[model samples]
Target chain A: MIILTAAPHMAVWGKWLGDALGTNAAGAPAGNAVFGIFLSLLVYLIGQWLFKVGKGFFLFQPLFVGMVLGIFILFLMAKVFGTTTAEFYKSAYKPGGDIIFWFLNPATIAFAIPLYRRNDIVKRFWLEITLSLIIGLVVSLFFIYGAARLLGLNDIGIASMLPQAATTAIAMPIAAATGGNAAITAMACILNAVIIYALGGWLVKFFRLNNDPIGAGLGLGTAGHTVGSAKALQLGSIQESMASIAVVIISIVVDIVVPPFAAFMGLK
Target chain B: MASQDKVPQTETTEEKPSPIIVQMAIFAAVLFVSSLISPLFPPSFPVPTPVIGLIILYFLLASHIVKLRNVEKFGDFMISLIAFLFVPSGIQLAASLDILKAQGIQIVSVVLIATIVMLVVVAYTTAGMIWIRKHVFHRSVDVKS
Candidate 1:
C-alpha cells in the first residue's frame, strides 16, 4: 500500500531532520544551542496557536501545552541520540534554555510598570491588601509545615514547600538557600499556578468571590504568581491590578519571612 | 511648585513610547545596579537581584524619574512573555524524574491541599476585610474605572 511505503520514508525524514539539527549518528549530544532556542520558541508558538484553535480551553493553556510538547520532543530526541533525557537536556537544551531563562529576571522587573500604574488603588487599599497577605502568608506557612510534617516529609520537603507561594524566580532561590531542592520548589510553584488557572473560576464561584475583585485578585496572584495574574486579567482590570500587587507584595514578604519561618520550624 | 508645574507639560509633550533602544538601556542600567547591590545583603537571607531591580524600578517610576512612556511598551512586552520565559525552568522537571518517581504522590497531594486552603483563606480574608470597611466604616471603596 502507498501508506505502508510512506511510513518508512517519514521515519527516515525525521532522522535526517534530527541529524541536520545537530543530533549525530554516533548518538552524541546535539551540542547546538540555537536548536534549543528554536525548539522552545517554535513549540511555544505551536502551543499558542493551538490554544487559539481550541477556543481558550483551560487544558490548552499555552504554557501547559508548550511544556508537554516540548518535553515529548526532547524525549524523542534523547531516544534518537541514545541518551537519557537529563543528559540531552544538559548537553543541548540547557545552553539555549539558560538564555531564555535569563530573561525571567528582567521580565520580573517589568512588573514594576503595573505596580506603578495602579499606585492609586494600591495606596487607597494598602492596609487591607497588606493585612490580608500577611494573614494568608502566616496561615499558609503553618499549613505547609503541619501538613508536610504530618505526612512524614523531611526538612528539605518542608523547606521547599515554605516558599511555594512565591513566584519561581523568587521561590527557587529561597528553597535552595533554606536547604531545599530548587527543582522541587519550581515544580510546586508551577503546579500551583496550573491548578489555580484551571480551577480559579470554579473556586471563585464556590467561595462567593464573584463580587470581590480585590479578594479574587489577591488570592490568584498570591497563590498562583504570573499565571494567576493572567487569570485575574480575564476577570477584570481591577482584578488584574490587584493580582499584580499581590504578586509583588507576596514575593517580598516571602523573601523576608520564609527563612526565619523555616529556621523556626527546625528546618536546616 | 515650579517642578510640580512642569510635570504636566512634559507629560503632554512625550505621549509616545521612547525608542526600544532607550528602553533596553534603562533596563540594563537598573539591572546592573541591582546586581551590584544584591550581594550586600547577608547570605542567610538572600534577596534575589530581580526583586531588588523591581523595587528600584518601582521607585523610579513613582518619582517620575523614569516616565511611564519610557518603558511602558517594552515592559508590557516583557510581562506578556513571562509565562514563555518560565518554560525553560519548567522543562527542567525532565531531570528530576527520579525524585518524582519516589515521592510524587505525596508532593502532589501536599501541594494540592495547601494551595486550595491558602487560596480560600486569602480570598475570604481580603473580601471580608473590604466588606467590613465598606459597610461598617461607610468608606467609599468603589472600584475606580
Candidate 2:
C-alpha cells in the first residue's frame, strides 16, 4: 500500500518512530514482528494473485515474488528516508522475519506426524526408500563436484557446491568448515530450493515418473529439502510423508558422509 | 433427558485441552528441547535438531503418549503452512542479490542441472527397487508357495 500510494512521507515517519524507540540499535534487537510478517504475507499474496492471473509464469513463485518485492520496498524506503538497506532491514524486518523463521524448526520436526500417519507405506517400502536415498546422495555428490570441477571451480567451490542438495542446517557448516564461503553455500542452497520448486512438476511430467508417491517423495526430498517437501505436500499426504522421511534421512547421511568425503577431496 | 445430556456435555467440555492443541503443544515442546540440545554438539556438528525433534515426535506418537487422533488436524495444518513459513527466507534472499548476481550463472546452472539429475536418478532407483522387490524376488517365493 505504501509503495502503491508513493507515501514517502509516511515511510519516513515510521523510520523516525523506530529510531525514537531505540529499537533500531545494532544487535539489541527490537522491531515490529507483526509488520514484517504482514509485509511478507502481502507480497506472497500478490505473487499468488499474479500466478493466477498471469497463467503461471515460472518466475513468480511466492518465495521469489515476496523476496523481490520485499527488497524493492526496503530499497525504495532507504532511498526516500535517507538510510542504508542494512539499517532498514535490521530495524524494520529482522525481528519479525527471525521469529517466523524460528517456526521453521518446529515445522520440520512436525514432519514426523505425517510419517507416523503414513507408517504403513513407510514400513512397506523402508528398505527401497533408504537404498534409493543413499544412492541418490552419492550420485548427486559426484555430479555436483564433477560439474563444479568441470566448470573450473576450485576445491572450496566444489566443497560448497557439494552440500547444495542437503538441508540448510546441515549444509552451511560443512561449507564453512571445508573452506567454502558460508554466504555462497547459503545462496546455493536457496537456489537449489527455488530451482526444484519451480521445475519439480515439469521434471516429473517430462520424465514420465508420476504414480509412485514414494518415489516422487524421495526424489523431491533428496533434491529439494524443505521447499521440495512443501511441494510434495501439495501433491498428496503420502508424498508429504515420504518426502519428510527422505529429508530426515538425507540430512543424517549427508552430515555423516560429507565431512569425510570433503577431506578425501582435499577440501580442508 | 435434557438435563442429563447437558451435564455430560459440560463435563466433557471441561476435561482437557483439545487433542489438536495437545498435539501442537507437544510439537512445540519437542522443538524447544531440540533447540536446547543443539548447542551441546561440537561447533562443527550440524545441529541435527530438526531430525531429533522428528524422532521425538515419532516416539510420542508410537508410544501413545501423544495420540495421533489428538494431533492429526494440527499436524495437517502445520504441513499446509510450511511454505508460508519460508516467506522470510525468500525475502532474505533480497539481501544477498549482489552475491547472487556475481556468481549467478554458475550457481544457478549447477543447481538446475544437479537437481534435475538427482531427482531423476532417485525416482528411478526407488521405483526400480520397488519393482524388483515386488515382481522378481517376491514372485519367486509366491511361485514356490
Candidate 3:
C-alpha cells in the first residue's frame, strides 16, 4: 500500500517537472517561456536545413518556413492545452518571442556597416540614386494606394501596404505609426522580399537591365529590401554596394514620405 | 574591375579583424548612444533609433574614428541573423489569421503586381538616369566594370 501511494506521488512530481520544462505528462509542449524560445530556434534551424536540402527553392526560405512551422506548432500546443492560439502565443510564446524580436533594432543598426563600406559608389552616383529612389518612392505609394483601394481593402489595409517598399525593420514601425497593422506590414514586407528574390533575375532580363548593375541594384534594394540586397550581392560587388545604399536611402525617404502621403490619401 | 583595382592596398594589408568581444563592445556603444539620441525627435515623425545609429556609425567609419575592421566581423554576424530575427514577427501573423484568411489571395496578388511594377519602374528610372549622365551630360564616369 505504501509503494502504491508512493507511485502516485512520484507521478505528481513528474507532472510538475514536465510543466516547468514546457512539456506535459504526455510529452507534448506545455505553455512555458523557455520552450517558446527553444521552439523558435529549433524551427528556424529546421528552416535553414530545409532551405539547403530543397536546393535553394524560394518556398524553402528560412524566414517563411520558420514562421509557418512555428505558428503551426503553436496551434498544436494550444489545442493540446485546451486554449486558443492567441492565448498560447501571449502566455507562452510572447515572452521568449519578444526577447528575440528585441535584437531587430541592433541588427538594423548593423546595416550601416555595409552602407559605409560601399560609400564610394554612393558618393559617385548620389544624384542618380536620389532621383531614382524618390521617383520610386512616390510611384510605390500611389501604386499601393491605388491597388489596395481597387481591391476593396479598407484604410487599415492601405496604410499597412504603404510602407511595403521599405525594409521590415523600418516598415513595421511606420505602419504602426500611420495607423496600420504592424503584423500585416511584416507579412507584406516578407511577401515583397520573397517575390523579388524569386523573380529578380527574370525582372532584370525582362527589363533589359543586363548592363545596368546600378539600376538593378537600386531596384532590388528599394523594392525587395534585405533579400533583394542578397540577390544583388550574387550579381556583383558594385550591385551589392549599390543595393545597400538603396536600402538606407529608401528607408529614410519612406520615413519622411509615408506620413504625409498617408494623410493625403485620407488614411489616419 | 575598375572598382576592384581602386580598392586601397592598405585594406588588404590590414591584419585580421578585432576580437569578437571588442567588436561587440563597439556595437553596444554605438547602439547605446543611438538610443539616447533617438528620443529627441518628436513622436509624430519618429525616426527609428537604428537609423540614427546607422548615421552615427557611418560618420564614425567615414572619419576613421572607428576602424572598419573593428566592427566588420560582428556587423556581418548580426546581419546574418537578420532573417532569423524576423521570424518571431512573422509568427505574429498567427494572431491575424482572420484578415489573412479573408483576403489572402487579394493581398498576395496585390503584393505580387505592386512589387513587379515597382521593380520595373525603379530599374528603368535608374537606368535612364545613368544613360542621361553618360550620354547627355557627357560625364566621364567610370563605367562599372
Q: Highest TM-score: which candidate?
A: 3
Residue A263, candidate 2: Cα error in Å is: 3.5
Ranking by lDDT: 1, 3, 2
Candidate 3 lDDT by residue in tens digits, B71-136: 999899889899999888888887877788888887888888778877777888888888999999
Compute the DockQ of candidate 2.
0.47
Question: DockQ of candidates 1 onward, in order?
Answer: 0.56, 0.47, 0.54
> By lDDT, is 2 or 3 better?
3
Q: Which number leads on DockQ? A: 1
Writing each residue's lDDT as its tens digit, candidate 2 over A1-268 gives 2221343466566546555433345554444576677787888889788878878776776666766787788777655645666566766676777787777676767667767866766666667777888777787777777887777666666777777666665566667766776546655666667787788988877887666666888888888887778788877866777787787677767766677678777776
- Sort order, TM-score high to low: 3, 1, 2
lDDT of 3 by residue, A1-268 (tens): 2212333545565446435644442323434668667878999999999999999999888888889999999888666555567766766677678788888877888888888877777778789898988887888778778888899887887888888887787888888888888888898888888898899988888778657888888888887888888898888877777787988888878888888898787788
Give candidate 1 regions above 4 Å deviation. Answer: A1-31, B1-13, B131-139
Give TM per candidate.
0.86, 0.79, 0.87
- Write the number of the candidate with greater lDDT, choosing between 1 and 2: 1
lDDT of candidate model 2 versus the reference:
0.70
Compute the DockQ of candidate 1. 0.56
* Residue-level error in angstroms, candidate 1, position A126: 1.5
| Share of native interface contacts recovered by each model | 0.65, 0.60, 0.64
